[model samples]
Target: MVPRNRSVRRTKAALQSALVDLLLEQKNLQSVTVQAICDRANISRSTFYLHFENKDEVLSSYLLQMIGRVHDALRAWTGSDDTRWTVYFAHIAHIAPILGSLSLDGGPHAILSRYERQFAVIMQDLVMPGRVPTNDTAVGYAAHYLSGGLLALTWWWVEEDRCGTPAQEMSRRYHALCSGQLCP
Candidate 1:
């Protein structure tokens, strides 16, 4: 759990930012080390340890915060599917830069088979028609499949500059799928 003290928050944020900057620079997790993060963040080992156990903890904490942001976005919109999805698309689009940068330098796959299972919990809580079972059920398969496709498409949409307005374009595509117009 994160401490409520302001100083602790700053320390943790520093560690998280340092990890990201290192990951972006090195392009892989294996290349990142606690010492590198400490050096980049400008925090000493004692200060870093006061907040996190290791570099992976920092990375996981950062990822969890990101996922929390997505959930917060989901909570902020409650309307028609198109409207909700448009808002969500806009939110995720703002996060595209990070995803686009995560090509990972030819290792530690980009949300392919690697992140699919882990991302399913978040996806299942999202716009599926019903509660998606987490086990090896058919519904679970469909949910993971959809999430993987969505993740891949988000990375592509941003990396390739598919459209100037991602929210609108992605929302249009969503409605088309809902209407059985896959080509649209």
Candidate 2:
């Protein structure tokens, strides 16, 4: 059972890695095919189908996995120290390729539109832990606003060519914005 679980993990990792490689090379997800993914991953067609329904499913799974990591990091953060932004920015920097690929060809826009509600719920939980907001609608709106602003800022940071800003500076700017010290 242990070996089987390891094999399953290895196969999924191979598939995910292949998809990322293809995404980087092509810069477009629409052009990527299951056969191409299978070829890149050196997995048979039957095996690919056994694991993922399609390329989009693979991409979605990868995004969810990445988000889970961010959530875990956020949960582990201790104290009210503003350095949490640094950790967040560093995670974003670490996943530059995924961000770059998603920012291209209106991919970010599509992703935000599709996942807006889900992201809002997650952000709200993160920002307001334990106690529920008195007004659910108001909290939902705030979550949407914050999530949209953060996504836009992230896309800008990732896409900017002249912006050689380090993660620490970005983190400081983010903290400033949250504190109303920097206007959006």
Candidate 3:
């Protein structure tokens, strides 16, 4: 359940912030410890446990919140359809730092897969009634294909100096790489 009380929200934010700080300092997630997170956040271990199972949980929650924001941007964008990628990548600036630290292993890949899944849903939701897929199977395949391409683009952007090129360039690359897909 999402926390409603402001105090609960504050505690969760502190824990996440502490984890980010630790990741920044350590250069690796495995080196960070729960006790360290508790100390950094100045929250009790019991309180931490109430909100998270482990350090990874804290990271996941933080990533999800970021992803949720991106999803909202994609949903709320009012510009041309071709610029959807820009809308999405624009929010990624907030997440690139975390992905950079986690990119050493498959951590970034895990998050990218989540992005694919979430993007597929967002695409389906945004589809016009007139453009509905002929069948559920077709939609599923297209979602996988398009979101996979998007994932690849995002991975490249993150690894390439956390968007060495701007989000507009990334979106341009996406539209150039593949266009006219019903999913697009």
Best by TM-score: 3
lDDT-based ranking: 3, 2, 1
Model 1 ranges with Cα > 4 A deviation: 1-8, 21-36, 49-57, 111-114, 129-136
lDDT of 1 at 138: 77
For all the candidates, what are their Cα RMSDs to the real structure? 3.9, 2.7, 3.6
After superposing candidate 2 on the true structure, give the runs of residues whose Cα lies further than 4 Å from its correct spot.
1-5, 133-135
Local accuracy of candidate 1 as per-residue lDDT tens digits, 54-98: 775786678678767766676566766655567647866765544
lDDT of 3 by residue, 85-132 (tens): 787787666567777788875588876676677767765665533376
What's the number of clashes in each of the models?
Answer: 0, 0, 0
- State which candidate, 1 or 3, has the greater TM-score: 3
Model 3 TM-score relative to the real fold: 0.84
Quick one: ranking by TM-score, best first? 3, 2, 1
